[model samples]
Target: MTEVLVVGAGPVGLALAADLRMRGVEVAVVERRTDPGAGTRAIGIHSPALALLEASGATDGIRERAVRIARGEARADGRVLAEIRFDRLRARHPYVAALPQSDTIEVLTALAPPVRRGVGVTSLRQETDGIRAQLDDGGEIRAGVVVVATGWSGRDLVYRPGAVRTHHYPDRYVMADVVASGGPVARVHLERAGVVESFPLPGGRRRLVAWAGTNEVTDADGFLRDAVAARTGTPVDIAGASTFGVRRAVAPALRRGRVIVVGDAAHEVSPIGGQGMNLGLLDALTLAPLLGPWVRRGDDAGLARWERDRLASARHAARLAFLNTMLGRAAGPSAHAARTMALRTALRGPGGEAFTRAYAMRFDRAARARG
Candidate 1:
């Protein structure tokens, strides 16, 4: 029997499986999709996440394929409002590494246990000694522990008997990849009109994300081109475009009996600050060490501790991400001015380092512990 059965083969599940296997635990991973997801998603890999990737021996490969961003700038009306210098960060990997989520998944998948593709856990029931997972393909898996990393799909299976609370923001974002001529500084333009963000990706490609109010954007390329040119005075050659909604949710608990949740399964935050994937990666790193004892001794106490700690950390990270979304999507002259001034003070004042550290998620005990 597998010691642990991971129900999703995304970055979170793959990271967990890799960590567990490295620790001598027998693990299996399952994914519903036969092929990997395409496109560049979650472009920012913060320092803490880089540390976790290093532990799994995946950072070197990822670094070779990622762009290193030394600082992040917030601007309005073509003027810089605030700057967060990631170069001054205390971590070993100071700068945020900009790589496509697909590439990150490739690195993790290479290090993880071989995943069973086109197969998904349909349902799970806790047994006396282990959890029994019903697969979509008429197969069943029984493992000492089951980790549901399906992120939002299997919430009904893993949430602790209570409804998960979710707050959906009115904001929508149109994102696209573009070829631009600029330095490697990640930038956010909080204009009175909308929010436009640019992050340098590997190759000559850069990712641009712009807040598109309630109106549906029919032409993403035209929209991004106008927005990027207007906000940053930088010309962009649009490559591809997509849209996504902004929302935040957290399960009441991260553990249910012999099964636990990680990544989007446990919580979700807005992509404003690029915290979602990094938070999930940290979840895998922090949860893996606790699983060793639970698998060997059936220690429910350790699982309980993991649940409490991770939930708190997720809440904290989600709050930060929400704040970022609010600042970026600030509308109207009064709100925009207030946000610009606040950000300027926060970034240029004595508390700038603390603010940047917090936003970068360096203060999380789990992240610091791994570092």
Candidate 2:
């Protein structure tokens, strides 16, 4: 029997399968699409994720192709509000690594088993011993556990009705990656209109994002250039751009009998803070070791603990993403000033280090230790 049958071959699924194989667990991965590596959707991999990814030996490859963001700045109205240094974060990798999602997938794919592309799990049925999965290509897979990592696209089919709750935000934004010179730092400009964020990528390129304040955008390149110049006084030569809205979704439970859920399938958060993908990667990292033992020995205790702790971590990440989204929206002068003050206080002295650790997603580590 296959120890673990991963239902999606995305980053999360690949990471989980890779780590499980490293631990000598039998695993198989299936993807619904033949090609899932098309976009640069997520770009920031915090220290916690980097540290967790070290087990699969993909962290070094990722870092080699990523820009290490050592610090971040918060500015508003042409004045510096606060500077948070990531070097102070207590982790093996003390910086946020910025790389296109495509690059990240490539690195992990090299380490994972051959993914069965163009194959999908149409349905899952629990058995007395193992779970049986029906594939879209008239095939079947029987495994000790089925992990749903198909992300938001597979939420409806993998989860029961009323199982997952979703909340959509009114905020809209446009972002693009272009050839530009930038340092190893990230910037968040809290303008009177909205927040403008810029991050350094590999190959001397930079990713720029600007909030649109619920307005429909027709010209992405024009809007990105105008917003960056207007808010941050930086002229950006954008080759192209894409617009996206934000939302938060979470399932109260991550496990249902022999079937389990991970990544965006279990919890989907806003992209403002760049925690959604990292949370999912960390999910795979945290679950791999526990899942192996359960699959081999039927040790349900570890899986129980894993579900409880993962749910707590997902909730905390969602709350953090919510705060980040709210803070980036358009604000008045007084509100901006208050936000700056709060940021300044939080990003100073001892609190600065603590905030950096929190932003690096050390809460999961702390929770695991406490558990």
Estimated TM-score for each candidate: 0.96, 0.96
Candidate 1: clashing pairs of residues: none
Clashes of each: 0, 0
The global Cα lDDT (0 to 1) of model 2 is: 0.85
lDDT of 1 by residue, 146-190 (tens): 988888787877654458988888888889887775678888888
Candidate 2, residues 159-186, lDDT tens digits: the string is 7787788999999999999887768889
Residue 365 error, candidate 2, Å: 3.8
RMSD of each: 1.6, 1.8
The local distance difference test score of each candidate is: 0.84, 0.85
Model 2 lowest lDDT segment of ten: 362-371
